[model samples]
Target chain A: MILVAALPQQDILRLLSAQSHPAIYAQASNFSVADSEAILSISHESSFWKRELHFQQLTQAARNAGSYEIGWDGYDAPKPSDDSINQGIALLNKIKEAGLSPSSVLPSADGGIGISFRGQNGRRALLEISNDGSASYAIYGKGHPRLVGEFSPTAANLAVVFNRLSENL
Target chain B: MKPTVQHLSKAPIVEAIIAFALEKPLTDSDAVFEQFYALIQSDYPSRNPVKMAQLTVSDQGSSGETQIVGARFASADGKRVCLVDQSNFICSRLAPYETWESLKSEFERLWKIYSPLCNSRIARVGVRYINKIFLPEGEDMSLTVRTRPEIAEGLPQSMFNFLVRLGVKIPDPQGVLMITEAQLPTERPGFVTAVLDHDLQFRINPESTDVWSLLDKARELKNDYFFASLSEDVIKEYL
Candidate 1:
């Protein structure tokens, strides 16, 4: 359903450049180097059962969300911009290295991407990264209390959150 | 299967290639060819030579058909050839193949001459060897060809001929080895000729000078993978 028709390489670049996110545009003046390196790192040498590669493929499928008129969900959702996808993949690489994979990697309504981790007792931690290179996380459960804040999307910080989520589960 | 071998006395290698893909067409390609011809013209005398392709004729007779390769230089026997153009430099030794060392030595010898003639901006380099083994009719194909195509159920269970290709990436040096296994057309009435082609290629720095080591290592990997993909019985037969 997430518009899987692949886009040409040049078209993808054109789409990225056409994005109106001024803050994200200012942060990343170019996507060529980042796109090539990040995509190659995940795809260069890989095998089945490699946890990190799943997210990378998902990111590609999300990036090619241009064939259909997406965002008909009424939220006027646009595909995650290049910055958001890059950060999301980097974060996923770290998490996957620690043997933690997200339940789903989906485009956010805010032109970003959300990686969700669901644990026992309704404990769920959703990490959302926006196109402006900003990341926020929300952890809540039915019986467990809520923990929410602007989290640094790094491996060390992810481990701290995973520790707390594992305890509640 | 024996996973390794130093050198097989009866290495079924049909064709061995030391191929270089240039980043772009050479400047003044016509003049560049003249410069290269001066160096290799003695060893490889013929110009624009044709390599023979073995074809299974409809009458069951086998014939060697000539395929016109553009701007090719060949030895008198036509077994050795250097096919050159604006964007490619492909040196090949057909059938009765020799050692990998000989091929690399020949490449290095000519590469020296060609490199100086044109500023070689190699985009990719490959060490490819194609081995052919003939199995008697009704023999189990898997004995010589270990790779098989997997088809889901309810599909046609029988196939006339098939080819399987596997791409393996080497992470350390950032290279790719593509292995192709196929049933080739043959003249032998009661035998099936199978082709096992292992092509190990990698993108290299255009200015990198240590290409010989890269090629040597790639051939090692290709040889390893080639033997690993065969059955033990086939190795014994070829040995």
Candidate 2:
């Protein structure tokens, strides 16, 4: 058995939350340390697990960066602000409350986080939350014109968007 | 609603699987040999079986040395099997899945044989189902409404290849379900093979919780996702 250093409790919590994208508590979840490490490894193959592997890599990279800052896609991207992470967490909670799962939760290049949803009907929706508590959305469906708008990250508004996406699911 | 025989299908959608986890790494592979052999010998009498090994290779491309670390036991028919290591326990049905009930029963039987030998408890449990949907010959992939339009659109005219994965928390049964749909590589003319994989998983204290309940929940989620993923017309035609 390969013995990797056990992550700290707080760090584990943060990593789990980031990996699950809905702020999942560590106590309520059963996750393999090996699987987590595999996800973080750059050598791992990408498949259906790609979104999760990327999230784990982001979390580890953020931890290595120190001070809860996330590197947005390895570029010289803006460091995610604490406020942005919190807002992203809040948005994730809202997404879950609406019974919707985003395809991925990724840190944006502009000190924010973005959640994406794809439908089987060629519809796609993205919800991006910035550090300033502002949010914007863009939705596109096959044959139909793309819809772009801004909305507060409230449960009701997120539900409306989630419902639209679910229609295509 | 239970799917009928015509809809349920003997030609299973799932191709293969390896679903299990370990609480702690096993130190001795020989500790459970007697029980393991006794349990599997009935189904798999073959003398030659693959064993898991640890290998060390030099960066200079020299021959690598292998050391046995674990073992995998397979049924004579090769349909059912179990893989065991210090901390991990995985069992899989390679192909032609009979039913969830059979798989669950087999898992339970194998776990019964394994639970006594391993000292550590089960920390996590995950059930993954891989479904392969073979499109009819000459059928336009776009014309099939089995999946949501967002996932079906924007395909190359000659070869349509795409992958969509989503992870959602199951509020009722208390777990996470990861759904993935992708186009598979195929050589058959005018045929497209799409795979819809559902991985329903949860972390739990194996000692306190009932494994059967979790398996039931996983099956429920699988059924829900399967039917929900397809259009009524498609379900009627191919389910």
Candidate 3:
């Protein structure tokens, strides 16, 4: 319940003038662009484009990881499902956005993805994105402590875990 | 003091949309549609399903299918439209561009009605403005077009027709300003028209219910890019 701004009411004069003026208060229009051959046929490229490329890379990696054969690991591990890959990307985006670099984003034998984080004091953390897009995380080192719980990326409730991983054990 | 944008005699907007994504999609499609139709029936009476054709190849021969991707709820006048799907709820106005104030007011009014029904937070908010610069026959496009050459990513060879798209970063709010420009064909020969579309958007905390500021900022940015895309001589035509 915060006040973003105090927006002024539309002036009475402008409202009256809008009825008769050809130049009304409307913003610019571009509806026909979608149908234009020039807009739909082609697009320009930029060598320095990286902002969108980051997410595209994540999605692509997840897709590639999901393509592994079931017996590729020499065990009876199943391939990660589409849902798990999507959830894995969600977790990857969170940690990437948190400014922490992960050691690797690997697919787990349990048909999910694990994001391994290496922190200071040689501490380690692992976030497992399950097949249903839910998460389970573990922090290893110093008796392993009490670092076992489900993580919800939607809630962004990973602050404590993220801090612990970035700091000392 | 509040700054005002000069009303152009010819506003170039083809479609302006304010889009919102729900935190979690409403799973009950039929119920959601019935409830939403009930809410918007007064303002947007006509309902039409938006479908996308899909071609599927399986063990059997390829089969073409149509998927109900989304739906559009339009007003009786056909000027205003509301587009809704599982996760997105968008309010749009087509041509005969009106003021931003009217659009904002309508969005707020509809959002209030649709919010409780969503049972989810607004995950993302975005505003898109599409402006097409129209030039009648014999009018020179060089006057309006900028000097900076935009390269099309498609075919390396010289192009007979192309569209330029650029995603500019907004450092302040951490969003992408997707600007799309393309020259369009005209019904009448030699008449030139180009479209400049600006869409400003960013992800936000679902809990952050205060969205008017973002919407207002998008409008401001839209206006800024719209005017900047044109040269002084061409802008004079709009003024």
CA RMSD per model (angstroms)? 26.8, 21.2, 24.1
Instruction: Assess each prediction's global lDDT (C-alpha) against the native.
Output: 0.63, 0.57, 0.63
Q: Mind giving the per-residue lDDT tens digits that candidate 1 earns over B99-188?
A: 888888888787778877768677778777877776665554544556656556667544445555555566657876656565543325
- Scored against the true structure, residue B203 in model 2 reaches a CA lDDT of 64
In candidate 2, the second chain superimposes onto the true chain B with a TM-score of: 0.75
**DockQ by candidate, in order:** 0.01, 0.01, 0.01
Model 2 lDDT per residue over A36-62, tens place: 442222111112233333444434443
TM-score winner between candidates 1 and 2: 1
> Which 10-residue window in model 2 chain A sums to the lowest lDDT?
A1-10
Per-residue CA lDDT of model 2 for B1-239, tens digit only, reads: 54332446544454334355666666666667556777678885532333433456677755644555556676755456676655566667755677777777878878888877876677666677766665654454445534432423364334344555555677766666666665543424555556677777666676756866777777766777777665555566554
**TM-score of chain B, candidate 3?**
0.86
TM-score of each: 0.52, 0.50, 0.53
Candidate 3 CAPRI-style tier: incorrect
lDDT of 3: 0.63
lDDT of 3 by residue, A34-54 (tens): 223221111111101112234
